[model samples]
Target: MRHTDVVIIGGGPAGLAAAVKLWEQGIRDILILEREHHLGGILRQCIHDGFGLTRFGETLSGPEYAQRFIDQVEKYKIPYITDVTVIGLDKEKKVTAAHKEGILEIQAKAVVLAMGCRERTRGAISIPGERPAGVYTAGVAQAYMNLQNIMVGKEVIILGSGDIGMIMARRMTLEGAHVKGVFEVQPYASGLPRNVEQCLNDYGIPLKLSHTVTDIKGRDRLESVVISQVDEKMQPVPGTEKEYPCDTLILSVGLIPENELSLMAGVKLDERTKGPEVNEKHETTVPGIFAAGNVLQVHDLVDFVSMEAEELADSVAEYIKKDEKAEAEHTQGEEAEEYMADVVTDGNVSHTVPQKISGKKDIRLCMRVRRPMKNCAIQLIQGGKVIQEKKMKKAIPAEMIQIPVKAGILKEKENLEVKVIW
Candidate 1:
């Protein structure tokens, strides 16, 4: 078995950033394993502009944004093998990967999980449709069109208003296809505001919220879709069904984090986030195993993914630097009577990350609301008392919410819950 200082799974933005940071931290024995032949991950298929505004201060396509990090790996001469799929991870931080070279076992001091996420396809979301040729997820269509230079269909009907669906609507429109409209089961648009405005509104594409496609017509190729409006319970309202003709149906329903390896490593997962539960340092329950980026939780922007990687790099470095101290803390963490402030959600709040927290350093808890609200305050409660609150002009589920708190305040409470109060 070969040994490395670190083994970062998945060579996407998160893994790339982690390698760069680890290199800067003087940790040279790092290896990144990517399943794909290329290292850019999903960014390579996304050819749209408007990325990197928050990070690079410039509008760039997905490939251009990823190229920046790829260039860094090449510049630093970091070691990474492509077309290597990591099969398993153990609690001891051992990694099993399979590549052209054959299966190999590597013992790593630390393992960073950046396997990213997978799209929810038609089967996962229960999209009732015939097995048709023109059906595709937004990402698959993107790869086919942008990467393979192929046309999916002449007419398209997009389901779900997520960023990808909206973007595909604009993309298909630009490619000389007629886009019928975008349908959403929820009352509010699931995509970002800018995406809705730029992709759909600017393109004169209709966005049908509180509506869902019930029946997908056609057997060989998509011919039409039966859509209907929904009530408060999200059930299709009777007699509200209407048929729309389309040659293609693209689904952008949702995404689930890739966690098979994490499960094998015996890492604890947060049910709400559908990802691994990480602490302030982004370390998972299993020591020396940390997760970041979309693997931990899906971020709305790729810039945040890079930011998460940078943060994870620092955490991994800390883990190696204070190896003994970290072990002691881990032991104490098991032996001691830890008073964890459980961040609960209520009112319009849907879910919160880092659900359980021990009063340590400052922590940032990310959350999403159940719906849209105006003039609300995020109330932090402990022992049935309001401890802290932050006001916001508006909060929407489409956008993620970041709440910061100091250890000093959290130490006073045994349990805490966050709620939206208007």
Candidate 2:
């Protein structure tokens, strides 16, 4: 058995970022486990140039962005074990992993789960289709084209207007394939607005909203797919079917966090995000075990993943150095006196983050309205008193709304309430 101060599972952007931060904080006894032969996770196959704008202040391809982090890890001499799969974890931070040589166990003071997410496939969507060779998830198609040097097909119909599907639509077009169109069940496209504009609209790709593939037809490979418009409930509308003859079909419906390890460890999960339920420190229900990146919540950009990882590292450092009993006492005292906040959603409000408030500290409340609104007023109320309010030119569910609370406000309030009106 081996022991480490910090054990980071998964060597993607999140794990690597966490390791780098740990090194900066003078924590040398850290280990990173990667199942793949190399690092970078899904970014290796993401060869597009839209990444790194937020982190590096320049547009870079996925490989380029990954290389930057890989270089940093090497520079810091962060130890990593590749081609090793972590099979089990316990609440005590004991990790059981395996490699070709043999199995190994580690007793870690802190463990960070950054295993990322998996793409939703045809089976997940239950699309009535033949088990044909041409059907592939958008990520699989990307790997084939970008890594294996294999063009998936000459013609394609993409299901799901997510970012991956939109990017692949442009990629297939550039690679001399005719992308028939993209079909999305929801009325609004689920991808980032910039991707929709730059990847699809700039390339003349048609986006079919409130639409889905009802059936697929083919023999050994895909021949065609039958699509139709969907009603408000997403049921297929009769008499609105159309057939598109294509050799390939790519499904990018959604992503599920790879949480088998978390489940095995008895960590609580959030139903809405389908990830672990974490506090402000990114620590799961089990103390000393943390999660970040896509494994916590599927983020739209790599920069966000990096930010989450850095935050987790900071938390881990503090957790390892602080006295457990003292910290628990402090936390209990803080929770006892902390004011609570209720974020009430009105028209077009979906959900809010920082679900609970730790009244001891000033909080930044973030939320999203359900629909787009013009000339909207966002109000922060406390016990029927208008505490803080702001007017905005526009509010959209796609963007996040943030409100900061100062210590002065908490001193005067017992509870926080947020609402939006137009």
Candidate 3:
């Protein structure tokens, strides 16, 4: 059986960044597994610029942003295997993967999961629709248009206001396709406001909020769709049915973190994020195993994903070294689980990362609001006392909110609660 110090289970931005960080930290025995023929993950298909602004202080296309790290991985000669799909994982840190040649197994001292997330499809939302050729998820349509030379349709109507859906509205328009409009079920847009402005507004596309696609009409290919305004409960309201003729229906409803492998490894999942329940170090319930990027929670920006993965890699290096030292001495380390405390939410706050924390070091609490709010104040409460707070002019579900807290303030706190007050 093959062995390595660490095994990163994806070659996307997250996995690449983690591998580079681990190498920099002097942990050279690492392996990256990529399911695609090439690396760079989804960024290869994201041709539009506006990425890397946070990381590089300059605008770059998705592929360009990813290539920067891919170059580093190559420069350092970080080991990687392409066209490999990891099939199994366990608490023992044993990884089983399938490849063109045959099944492969590896035993690693530590594991990092960076498989990212998947788009919510038509079946996920159970959209009442016929099996038609013109219907495609926003990501699939993006791959078809950007990677493949095929254009999805000439007349398009997007069913969700997600970032990808909005971007595709512009993409299809630039490709000479007529985008009728974009309909969303929620009262507010699900995508970032900047995307809604640059992609939809700038392209002269209409975004109808509180609306949804009710039924799809077609035989072999898509012909038209039935749309209706949704009530407060998100149920389709009667007497608001409208029909629009379009050849394509694109969905960008939402994203789900890919965690099937994490589950197989006995990692506890957060019901809210549908990802692994991780501590401040990005360590899952199973020691020696960690998770980052979209596999931990869907991120709004790729730059943030890389940054989070780097942080996780730092923690993994520390874990590996600590374990080696313990092995050399034949002594078990001290248990610090008692210092861990749950990070809960109150008021309009939705969910948070580091679902729990040890308060032993400074940490960033990434979270989102349940709805839009103006003139809001985010407060971190510990043991009935306010420890840290940040005032924001506005908070929206589309944009994630991150607040930094110091360990000095959180030390000895039994629990922490985040509240967004408007």
Tens-place lDDT per residue, model 1, 1-422, is: 99998999999989998999999997889999999999999999888888899889999999999999999999999999999988878999999889887998999989999999999988887878677788899999999999899999988889999999999999999999999999999999998999999999999999999999899989788889999999999999999999998899999998889999999999999987789987777888888899998999888989888887898899898777666465767753224444555667786786777676777767777888888889999998877888789899988888988877887777544767888888
Model 1 score (lDDT): 0.88
TM-score for candidate 2: 0.89
Model 1 pairs whose backbones collide: 344-417
Between candidates 2 and 3, name the one with more favorable lDDT: 3
Clashes of each: 1, 3, 0
Worst 10 residues of 2 by lDDT: 333-342
Segments in model 1 whose C-alpha atoms lie over 4 Å from true places: 324-340, 383-385
Q: Write the per-residue lDDT of candidate 2 for residues 63-141, one digit (tens) a residue.
A: 8988888998999889999999999999889999999989989999899999999999898889996777899999999
Ranking by lDDT: 3, 1, 2
Better of 2 and 3 by TM-score: 3
> lDDT tens digits, residues 47-113, model 3?
9999999989999999999999999999999999999999999999999999999999999999999
The candidates, ranked best first by TM-score, are 3, 1, 2
All candidates' lDDT scores? 0.88, 0.84, 0.93
| Candidate that would win on lDDT | 3
- Candidate 2 lDDT score at position 137: 92
* TM-score for all models, in order of appearance: 0.94, 0.89, 0.98
- Name model 2 segments beyond 4 Å from true: 323-349, 362-374, 377-418
